[model samples]
Target: MRPLDPRLLRYAAGARWFFAAGAVLAALQTVLTIAFAWSLSQAIVGVVEGRSLAELRTEILVFAGTTIARLVVTWASGSVSIRGAARVKSELRSRLYRAIGRLGPAWSAGRSSAGLTVLGTRGLDALDDYFGKYLPQLILTVIATPVIVAVMFWQDVLSGVFVVVTLPLIPVFMVLIGWATQSVQRQQWDTLSELSGNYLDVLGGLSTLKSFGRAERQLTRIRVVTERYRVATMKVLRTTFLSGFALELGASLSVALVAVGVGMRLVAGDIGFGPALFVLLLAPEAFLPLRNVGTNFHAAAEGVTASEDVFAILDEAADAADATATAVHPGGGPSSAATAPAGLEFHDVGVSYDGTTVLSGVSARFAPGRVGVLTGPSGSGKSSLISTLLGTVAHDGVLTLDGSPLPSGPGERPWLAWSGQRPGLISGTVADNVSLGEASVDPDRLTRALALAQLDGWDADRECGVAGSLLSGGQAQRVAVARAFYRALRPETRVLVLDEPSSALDHETERRLAASITELAAGGLVVIVASHRRRLRDIADVELALTPAVAKR
Candidate 1:
């Protein structure tokens, strides 16, 4: 997470070899460039001194061969490096996706679809520069530039030291410029991500807002946010272009100085024409890499910003590692009890987000085979309580499950199946949407669960449109319930949580859905629903009325 960390390299353990080989190729190319220039000078000077034609021919052949070798190595390195960088990007993207999948609500609640899409798409794309272009070029510049300058020094110290002294300025300015622009680039990326998230939310809910004549206002807000991001982006771009221009100007001036000095020495007869010409040809290659590093530094600025985002998402408190599994793995800890009586209990528990409290001090108990309903006015802490029990929210007090304090990690103790108050809609058959996260779901179980939610009537093979577009809100809610049913059908399923279970349903449908939920709970499943509707209170084994606070024990 440090600004200067070589994160992409650390993750690219397997592909570093290819990168190293690419660096070698770059060095070889630089060596060949010098060798070719050196050979040409020797041949010409030898001819001028009345050397044999056959010797001249030999030098020419050697120079030609080295040039050819340089080209071959350069070409092969491009191929190998591009493929290797692509491999790194692919693997990193996969890890990112899997990590996000595991993170679930922890990340999803805070991010937007467009933002995540960008993170997965162009955001991950910055790694290509890190590995393919910048890394290989940087390595070659470091390895070959000094050696070339040393050769120039041996040929003529004045020219060698001249380039050597001026050479570091490119990288020096790069560091300075990169440092100056780092914060700005980072801000630009963050603003872009925020814009992406907001845009997705706006588009997703545009229809609803339009029905209430709020679409114009939403668009205005989006434009304001986007313009702000644009200003930030323009500022970063200005700095980036300046860095590149400075590097280019500095390199050009250095090369010009080398050319003028070499020409003067050749005229003075102090250094022979042959060595002087060679220095002139090879001087730019020394500075080219440094200039390139500056260019690459700016080119990869977004990638650097994007990579920072990727790392934050990847490391955002990874699903609090399974404590028992970890404890048992290394030190051989206690065994997991079959009935540890690890039911969830909350006492004086409260939670909040962004400094605004969502849940206040609360006390509750969830026992196996019992049904619990949390009811309150809209914006009350019913849903937050469920999140507290699930450990998705930061809590102020104690929460225990099955007599053991609930593990603070996600997907750990008290395995829960949460059917969110707001269900996801996707393009597919009814069956597909109901079974998005499940692997190899049973058809019979699927049929039963669908029936429980009163969705048995819909044709299973019919297209639901994108996100069950063919279905009405009540129908989608029923399908979502069916999904909860499918998850609960698992033999290991212990706790099933629902939010607004009957929000989309009418009187009769709500009645049926309530009955279905009761049937599930009656069969030893721990069912918890957050609702304000009085209709579901009848079936709840226990009813909890939540407000701003619950008295501490």
Candidate 2:
């Protein structure tokens, strides 16, 4: 049940075919195993009874052929299982990536990059054993065990009784071991996630640690986490080994009991020589798949644990998306004409995070052909207000567009554009970063945007390393501003929002950027800027200041 997490089977539609094929191959292998065992008995009994070598040769060949076929089918089934696992892993990773994107930066801000990384990469890769060995063996146990046992009964009823009685014990022991190892496996997986997150975090802050003269102390922390992980892993391995040994011992004893029964019956002349020998050979075959399943389960437990965590995230994301979808206005909500920007009205609007109210009972209005600046101290919710308007965060009370309730979801408004405090850039040329998937890059418009943001000296073709590392702080800010302008140039863009636009700029550059905001407002777009700088506030047609909410006595 733990191995068969429903979310995996439910979400990975493309990979289901591989599982189906593996089950079919398992059935085929089961048939071949029984057939080979029958032919092997026939060849041995015929030779012992002094039959012609020519007659026995046919049984020998059939046995050999069945053996070869089983080998080939097993190899093919293994290949199919591995390919299916890869496909499932790929599909799950894609779904996770898309879900993370839909959840937006706010949700991601609360999670560790290293933890998510390990979940998507190493955590998923751990499923290889589950799919490739454990699942196929499990299918064989389900399909092949009863059939082989029935065949044993047909050959000799006493030996079949022994197998039937002993088969239940294997699963009984497996369940007991599973109970003990389940918690340990879960603990090991959690430890692994912690280790991965801590190591990546330490590495990211290595420079800060060195500057603060605390770099060497971090080694002790890392070592402690690593040792904890090692201990957890060793505990899982010990339980797995002990469980495997116990199952093997039980299977061996069961086979021996059947062998002794069959041999005693032959000595008493209660069964034919051929039947006795056949039952002896077939007794162990009945338990082989079941024993292998027990052995393989340990290898797959880690993946099952990781899969539970992945499904939990996917489910939460789906619920959030469903909630947002219901909140969306069907008629595309409020829209502005090409010549005028939409008016925005906040009526006692409020926002909260983790039970702490950031903005409460605030009201404001900004209209077309006007610039609105939000002035506030840190943690006074200027950025949160911008996020609310952009539909990134849910808010209580009402926000209206042209005097109607606004749509309540991120990306619900194509007309809105925003530039955040930290500019996010990929590893690409300057033009690539600014154009950002635009089908046609207009040289004139790009040049104008860059000039307005005071980035005219930067080469359009120059490479901007990851997160714009090649550029200085102020230059990166300008690049983000230029991208915002380029987006605002689109015919559908009616509202422009900038958060801390001049935080990295000097007086001259800040003045130039402020001029650009006013120019955007003059062109009939409602422009909103969240900044503390006087240069930006001085240029705004309307200024809204926010204060921290007071606690009631």
Candidate 3:
């Protein structure tokens, strides 16, 4: 990716204002720097010519005032740039998170959780250096470099010509060095992602490894991955140092050439002391921004790599959503919702994984005030069918509401609630997770939902440590049930689907959960459950028995 990809600006806010303000500040600072140098040079010449201290008072005051003003301008510029960059980062992170959520199980199945975690956290944080340092300096370089050179030319054309001619060397060296190291930097990013993924996976499966007496074996694998990542990181750092050295060398040589020209002209009595010193001071300033850019490019490179990955995910999600929408609405018109009496219907429904059909030609009907229990063998695609209804995965055949095809987009299924086989819980209070992403929380409704999920005696304010580690497995499962019931508070939600909600419970608890399902259905909600427990199936108003694709054929 380029240092400033257009897609970043499209998603990030306040970039235009940040860059514009940076340019204005750079111009002001450049003018002040030149004036301070001119004043100092004049003061020195005046003092040497037997002038009194009082005679140079004006020059001294000018120098001090410009110095203070320059400092203030720089501080203000940095403050604005930082806030703008933060705003952009925050907005981009939120958008990426929402896009991932919309992609659902399809994305989860295809992506590495550790890789995505790194990209969202440490990867996005890399932009700090890119914005706080590189971007501001980049603007300064563009504005200050040429203007300073032009002023030096006005003072003494020969010295100005030398600076103008040699100044291009810094950027030229930077471009060459950057071109050579781009591939190495990309490799470093990939290595970091791989290492992060491996470490997370190992940590998650550590208990299993211990049980099988393979923990020691996995240690060696972890060490090898870490060493590889360390080597890749070192290579990136070495490249950065080499590039910085080359830029420094080119800039130093250019400044030295300008100094030599100015000194010779001074010796020949062609230029006065004040103008000579001014030209000399301004010569180095010309290359400073470009040099800084090369130095900060290392940070910029990491951010760019991460950004490429982030944008790729966003783009792919959008394409998938578009395709799903097209499939849902084949006539290129909005899909009509099936009317109330029929509730939800599936006709000749099928699902496939890795090109093999999991479920085929399955038909079922679910109506209001009824509970539909989906029962089948282990590989019969029971969960797959529920995921399709919940809009987590795409499906073949027609799923309709009142004989009208269901809408394709994930957001269009707001009226549907799902509690997956694995309960989704984060580290927060019971109420927090129950009301996750909700705009408001109702105490009475919350209490009722908890009761319905069999979560009695649990405090709403109790902390559910990371993934509900603070709660027992059954308690966590009940919390998932509570979350689904809370979502069912919406008047539009006519269908509730629970996938293996009884998996973590005892037989008695499973009976209680089944009773809750029957109660919700009695209250006029269409409840669909995919479960192996007969206790749950016994309460069903309708039972759909599915078979594997081969058996059906």
Looking at model 1, residue 295 earns an lDDT score of 82
Superposed model 3: Cα runs more than 4 Å off = 48-57, 321-341, 347-363, 395-399, 402-405, 412-414, 428-451, 454-465, 549-553
- Residue lDDT tens for model 1, 87-159: 8778778877866756646458776778888988988787677655676677778777888898899889999
Candidate 2 local distance difference test against the native = 0.85
Deviation from native of the Cα of residue 361 in model 3, angstroms? 5.8
Highest TM-score: give the candidate number.
2
Residue 478 of model 3 has an lDDT of 92
Ranking by lDDT: 2, 3, 1
- Residue 127's lDDT within candidate 2 is 82
RMSD of 1: 4.6
Point out the worst 10-residue segment of candidate 2 by lDDT.
Answer: 328-337
* Candidate 3, 85-127: lDDT as tens digits: 7877787788789888778876578778888999998888888
Global fold similarity of model 2 (TM-score): 0.92
Candidate 2 wrong stretches, greater than 4 Å: 325-341, 398-406, 410-413, 438-440, 550-553
lDDT of 2 by residue, 1-553 (tens): 3647767777788557876897799889989998898899888899888999787888988898998999999899888888988998898888888777777667888998888999999888988988887888888998999999999999888888999999999999889998888989988888888898988888889999999999999889989999999999999999999999999999999999998888888999999988888788888889999999899999998877777778888897889889876653222223333433458877777777767787788878899889999998998899888888776777676677676677665555777778999989889988998988788889888998898788887789988899999999988888988999988877888889999999999999898889888898889888999999999989888999898873432
